[model samples]
Target chain A: MSNCIDFYFDYSSPYGYLACERIEAIAAKSGCTVVWHPILLGAVFKITGQKPLTESPLRGDYAVRDFSRSAREHQLEYQHPAQFPIGAIAASRASLWLRDNSDPQLRAKTADFIHAIYRAYFSAGQDITDATVIAAVAGSLDIDSEALLLAIATQAVKDSLRIEIEQAISAGVFGSPTMIVNNEPFWGHDRLEQMERWISSGGW
Target chain B: MSNCIDFYFDYSSPYGYLACERIEAIAAKSGCTVVWHPILLGAVFKITGQKPLTESPLRGDYAVRDFSRSAREHQLEYQHPAQFPIGAIAASRASLWLRDNSDPQLRAKTADFIHAIYRAYFSAGQDITDATVIAAVAGSLDIDSEALLLAIATQAVKDSLRIEIEQAISAGVFGSPTMIVNNEPFWGHDRLEQMERWISSGGW
Candidate 1:
């Protein structure tokens, strides 16, 4: 049986972006596949009654310090994401629509698009809240930028987001970059290694 | 004004119990007061999209490894708490009432209560889920065990628990053993030093 990890991601999260980048390598090494599910992180928070990281100064301050520690531990290149809490709604919708095509390379291409958007926001310090950056991301994916834009423009994407939020709540998901394998949810980027460990243990 | 750290605690949590023992010493040295708040960790999980440590095999696995490391680093005498997800409701309700009595010796006494409870559960392999054990904890306080039991039997105590839960959700808390000073929450025992730093800075 093929082992799969269902990843719930939001483009605005630096850890989500980092996890997206690192998980594939980890998954490949562990003989597992990542199933990407893009959902609005803001909505997840609203439904779950979570305040932003900025609310608990510890969360924000520790996030800054913790990410530094994590990057070093993982041996990944990371600096603080320049514009935090960047608008992720658009990208989330686009990725949901992209899944309908169901191409085998869909997950990889979508990851690339998401990674590029993260770079644009965190590294390039561009306005990911701007539609042009999103369109550029879709264009780079060779996905029809116009159709993708139109799809996100409709309520279809919005409704999909609603369902995703509800499902995540029901599943007891609390934070970003959650990996669910075999009905179990693994939270946080730091947990990626444990996910690999579980897979190597035969996806128990 | 004496600096205060708003403390989030659950009775059956060995870490919460251990922290109560050490925090007093740490605070005395650092010079701060622990304003204890009895909150249900279950409610924190419900609202914050978090799962109990019991639910995440990966988190549970990591916690075991991490606690072993923390034990060494903090120079703590720790044996991992067994019979986890033990009913903490009684403990929190007991603490809420205990704090109200305002005995001059509450701080030191509270630390002793926590130490005995943690050691009983972790080292002595006692079932803290048993009411007899809980009654013994109450007895250790020298209050009439029956009166303490009767006090925890009220609707008012449950309401106080609810209010504490609401406050934690409002404060953006997502985990246990969270410390707060002047409405600033510093989560995890690891962030205790930063909580101290924030108090010194007057940046709030």
Candidate 2:
């Protein structure tokens, strides 16, 4: 009976960053809550037979251009990362650590961590694959930096992400910034408007 | 220099059909003309390592739903063709045949033929892979059916489509509904808004 939307994203996706920037406002307007699921897109790609949009030949060039243009259009600061499509395992595990804490304050901290990571990768052009960078981001977010890094390296945390990724793939998520509402999947950040309309109308 | 937008599409692309339904109006409002270039997406796919979107695993299901929902959002009548991602060789060749003819009036008829084929394949759910069906769609636009069929079968027409496909690929056109303005590429029907804004602002 909850009017909650499940948002799936990979840390390295520019559009995922863009979607993260907007989804909260769209949900707030409709009195809905979003449950964020940060997963490794590489796992999803294994099942979908897709590569990173920026690695797909001609689309790679267009994607690079559109990433900047779309960010500007949305009035969000963006600079292409030096190490793009970086391995986001650390970031994803960091998010899971925050989400699993069950402390409401720490739960709020999850958003801060996710947003900072996105900004670090996209706006500041940082390499998020480095555990030191991720720990620094969490430290800036007022979370325990050393603790977060240790948690991200734990076997339990790694397995948690692996299991959830398998579940996400089986649940039909093959792309970043895919939203699931009432069991219907909506893919792409551009679809936020349609998703808003669907939420408002309870779907057609 | 003409302020014309080069529109590239594949007949089997639902997004391409959706774009065909809208691009002319968007251009007319901006005092820009649209030059339609219908090419085989398969050729682009060869370079990009992408298959028909509907053939992808989890993404395939989402695409079908998005196609219908997006169509309704635009108030365009849409019925998915029974044979999707169909062999569009006949349709593309037919379009080139119409385009290659030097008569200005016949060139104008090309739009009529293109729209009809889109409607036949998408709205009417007709199998446009059939040469007879393509000729029939052309016939609806007052083109001679038998002559159209014969023209679509010509080696020149087939070769003409091949050269354009190569040209589109070389031009970095990797997807359907790609719009090129001032030599910058904009991909997707979703980017039509951005395309309009680009035309209005004459590029950022």
Candidate 3:
């Protein structure tokens, strides 16, 4: 009755951040291991017909209420990213570089980074294009800030993040924080408990 | 730390029917009591500016895919209901009538009645406007079909259903199967685990 949970993530997704925040506790409770799988949201959206905030019809008036209900229900804080579709390339790259050699607890740390970045972008209307905030988020998790910057700059990490994006596309992942446990995919933060229960129950 | 859970429902909402199926199981697990609420979808759409299905941009189309994934993850069977948006006045009235006979474990039976009606509309694509199916559904529930239908016609059950709707509106019930523990509302079936946890932690 053992399995590994691969959590697909993107820094720009507040929902992804929400899953990162608490999925580990659930995983622990359900007796499963967590793996961090960072993918490019931009790529996933290209094929999924998923549009950024400004492009979605319900955005200007309804999205705020829509997401607020979901976020508040999940007990995660959000305001709206200041910059629409903030370039997540660097954030993804840093996340990739910090993989394996860094903490596998990346699940929890990544959740934190997603929240801080969402707050930075949507609520305060800050520039997520700045490497400083990204680095600060990494630093807050005790991961090396300077190293994260270097990692973001390295072509290897950059290309790796790009590959992760490609991988998400090839694997049919269309959303953030898609918890893939035992090769079963649960697409939203709302599906987290279902994934854990799937694992806990040995995939039924 | 006890609070009433006001469940807002549109008898025509497939999602509401879906949520109703396992709601009491969820409530028992979460230690919450559900106040069965029935609101007219036609009325809600009029006030909230939520468009009717034919006008709402097929947002629900893609949602079926997501819900399919969720259902699979949860190990639940989700055959899309047959008939949707059936004339729910009778069913809603009947549910209000059943409230007087509250049984802690009867939600599943209640859900069956709701599901049968949804099937009458969506899957069968029948005119749920048919009195026969409505009578059949109520009869199947082991409820007195003549009495229930008579109650719907007499304004007795209709008035009770209206009061439940007003109660839900006053309690800020925005959606169905909403779990309110200690007056804090958690809308959607997905939040059942958190609702349970919130209760276990004494409303945190």
Candidate 4:
């Protein structure tokens, strides 16, 4: 019964990016803190037997359309990245690295790194799979760029991400933007309203 | 574009059942007519390579929980049917039969039939795969029970359903409760708000 919302997301996910934009506000409204967990959907999909939204047959097209439509609905700026469904390992590991930093101020910037990295990929259409681009995005936020690049490449940071993905799968998360509130899992960006309701009402 | 919302749903889908409860009201708010297309998800799943929500590994459990949570969110009565993810072929054909009926009154009850069948399956916990159960639900709605049953049994009615399903697939419908407004497809009950916004504003 902790006052926390576990926000599980993959950096390559459009819906995950959309959720990142609003999840904080939703969490704050309910007096709850959000714990952002960036996991590789590629690994999770292996277990779930699911494909990326933009790669699935009929759903791929619909997903692309819905991504932009949903962004507009949320009043957020969105551009479909030319290189979508990219390997988000660098960005995800960077997020974990920031969170694991010993300095409190650096650790607190994990959320900032997440938002910036997501914006770079989804809005600016940057290739986040590249460690250089990830470092640049981190540097833009005043985080130590060299430290981030070095950290993400380390065995510890990579294993942290791997372990996190395994933990996410064990937690019954099969998709992006899954918010766990009070042990109840809500999947997808569309479920945010329902999650908010669950938070406000303390579980119906 | 036509001022119609094409609602494609499968009876076995819980989200489809949830969408059935609110789609008419959503359509009416935008001064649009609802054209209900009952299609088989089993057939769609063959093309999409999807398993039913209650049958998928991790998602199966979450979907079962979300079914009741979503129903409660909409203030609709719901019970997890003991027999879930039942083959909805009988109910699908029944709906098509009602829609194709020569009698204007019988044809007009297509929406009623959809709602009743969904409620019978999801709320009343009845085995909707049973044609007798579908007939009983339709009979309770003042629809002609014997004639409806006989109509669904015909090869013509079955082919009508097949054609409609094919048409639905052709229209890019790969999941239940897909509402196509202005040729823009919106999938899932979760997308209703976005779809309503699309209808009200005529797309972004």
**Could you tell me every candidate's TM-score relative to the true structure?**
0.57, 0.94, 0.63, 0.95
lDDT of 4 by residue, A94-194 (tens): 89988888899899998988999999989998898887888788888898899888887899988999999989999999999899988899999998988
Residue pairs clashing, model 1: A174-B49, B6-B180
Over the stretch A1-204, how does candidate 3's per-residue lDDT look in tens digits? Answer: 665777887767766766777777888898777777877677765554456644533222334544565566667666776555656777667666766445576534654565566566655667767888888777777777886788678787778877887776665567777877665667677777676666776765
lDDT of 2 by residue, B1-204 (tens): 438999999998999999999999998988888888998888788888998998888888888988998899889989988777776888888888888787676777988888998998899888888877887787778888798788878899889999998899889999889999889788899888888888887766
Candidate 4, overall lDDT?
Answer: 0.87
Cα lDDT tens digits for candidate 3, B1-204: 454555667766656656766676766666566666777756544444444443222234445655555556555555554554454777677666666545544444665666676655544555556667778877877766786677677666678877776676666554555555566676666776666666676653
Candidate 3's C-alpha lDDT?
A: 0.64
Candidate 1: misplaced stretches above 4 Å? A102-108, A202-204, B1-116, B119-204
Best by lDDT: 4
Interface RMSD of predicted model 4 = 1.2
Cα shift from native, residue B38, model 3 (Å): 1.9
Can you tell me the CAPRI class of model 3? incorrect
Worst 10 residues of 2 chain A by lDDT: A99-108
Give Cα-based local distance difference scores for all models.
Answer: 0.67, 0.87, 0.64, 0.87
Best by DockQ: 4
The worst-scoring run of ten residues by lDDT in candidate 4 chain B lies at: B48-57
Kindly list the per-residue Cα lDDT of model 1 for residues B1-204, writing each as its tens digit.
546677787665545655665677677766687777767777665544455654553345545655544455456666766567766676666667666665665434655565666667766777766657768976866756687678778998767777777877777666668776666566666556555655665533
